[model samples]
Target: MRAVIFGASGLLGRSVVCAFNDMAVTGTCFSRTAGGLVTVDATSADDIERLLSRDQPDVVVNCVGERRPEVWAETPAQARGRNVEAARLIAEGACRYGVRLLHISSDYVFDGKAAPYRPDSLPNPLNAYGRWKLLAEHAVRAACPDAAILRLPVLYGSAQFAAETNLTKIARQVSAGVPMEMDDVCVRYPTHADEAAEVCRRLAGALLRGQRQGAVAHWGAEQGLTKYQMAQLIARRFSLSAGHIRAGEADAASGDRPVDCRLDCHDLPAALGPLRRWLFHTEFPPVVEPWLLPARPVSS
Candidate 1:
């Protein structure tokens, strides 16, 4: 099926484009240039309509976000416009064009008080970012009854190494002997972007086959790991000193995140294993090695 992915320059968006190579994929990017891609003025509905008309895609997957939580806290207006309003316009356009929309949402839609939440579970977002995401979900539902909502956890992959991901950024900072403060109180499953993209591809196929329930599918590692726990795991894998990773809580003083928004995948075979394996490769990739400090000097 022909597909259009908004925010195609970002990590998840890029993966989605790569995953759908067999199909006619139109990846929209505003900040960076990629081969055979066009930029979209996301704030304008007319531009999006023009794009939809030109591409004639069967599915539209939106991965755009005003990503930084701290930025969302500081600029709620920008977050609402990008996260909520943009999705609304896209969903409306998808409805008008009689195409399906697969919007990427986050597990942060739930407040931290709960653990291992299913899609139907009530959402009580504690931070501005989560609130905006929840608002976008509602907007999509209101605009397009048959659109699919896929809520994912912290996504990381080798696709965008050094391009600022949860795994890459933390690895770089900690390996450099720069202390990294992570949230011990807030917990989530870290899923690979490649896996998320695969799910999107499969779901889009299902959509094309007339499987559109507007259902929300949750995909994440089954294990609930705190941010500090993830940091420590990455450090150990890199053989970096654990001292580089500090345990802290997520709050207004510390980036304003949820307390326990880990997701439940609802028995999908692809959902993270009963084995509870770490989402990343056990060995540090070569690109990450440069960020690591030289082995500590040994004293006799």
Candidate 2:
């Protein structure tokens, strides 16, 4: 089985690459071309078409997107280019080449007013990022009717930088003994990138076998936690004091966020057997610890 993974240098993409290690995989990146990742401008239709023709892979997984909500709110055009245009180009290429596509989407597509959302649920995105993602989904589906769409929540995994992901950023602050306020209001299901990668691999396999065509599925951690609870877990794991971390309302500066977008994930479990979720207490420490700064000296 041959596969092409776009945005292969990203958090989820890296894990997806590892998950498909047994297969012939070609990983592409836009700018961060490390670990032998091929550089390809995903927004360019010609670039996408050329790659699809050259690789001739049975499956294509798109992991590229502007995940920053503030980017969409601040610079809508740039964000739309990355999030929507890129996806459209990829989907067009996949349709032309008759290749199976699995596109990564976000849970933000739905307003937090609804607790657990299914695949068929009406998407009422509140923020620009969500709105763009929803648009991207429509574009992808229109271009490639058989494309598989997988919606995921906040992801945490091995990152080169602490700021690459929200959870690792919190871990960084906690490790530094930096006094900070975390959101106790919004509920989030932070899924590990590795777990999402596994789901991607399984779905890709199914797609190759002529299954799950035009299917929309959700994969998220069943455990619901807030930024405050996540910080506390990080503190406990590293034996660091969480005294400086206080639970409060969501940071307004971070931009508009959902209250709770817990995904039902019924389709994924039904299609792929049981959903595999990693335990936060056991799996999170190693993923975040490597990026943490050196411990500061205690003041006398």
Per-candidate clashes, comma-separated: 1, 0
Q: So what's the TM-score on candidate 1?
A: 0.88
For 206-284, candidate 1 gives per-residue lDDT tens digits of 7777774577888776566675776677677766777866787644245556766777776444532232334454423
TM-score of each candidate structure, all chains considered together:
0.88, 0.95
Whose TM-score is greatest here? 2
Top lDDT prediction, candidate number: 2
Residue 201's lDDT within candidate 1 is 81
| Each prediction's whole-model lDDT (CA) | 0.78, 0.89
Clashing pairs in 2: none
Off by over 4 Å in 1: 159-163, 250-256, 267-278, 281-300
Question: Could you give candidate 2's per-residue lDDT for residues 1-300 as a string of tens digits?
Answer: 889999998899999999998889999998786778888999898888888889999999999999875677788898899999999999999999899999999999998888799999999887888988999999999999999999999998888788899998888888877777889988889888999999999999889989999999998998989999998888777788899988898553355677889999878778878757787678888888887778888789
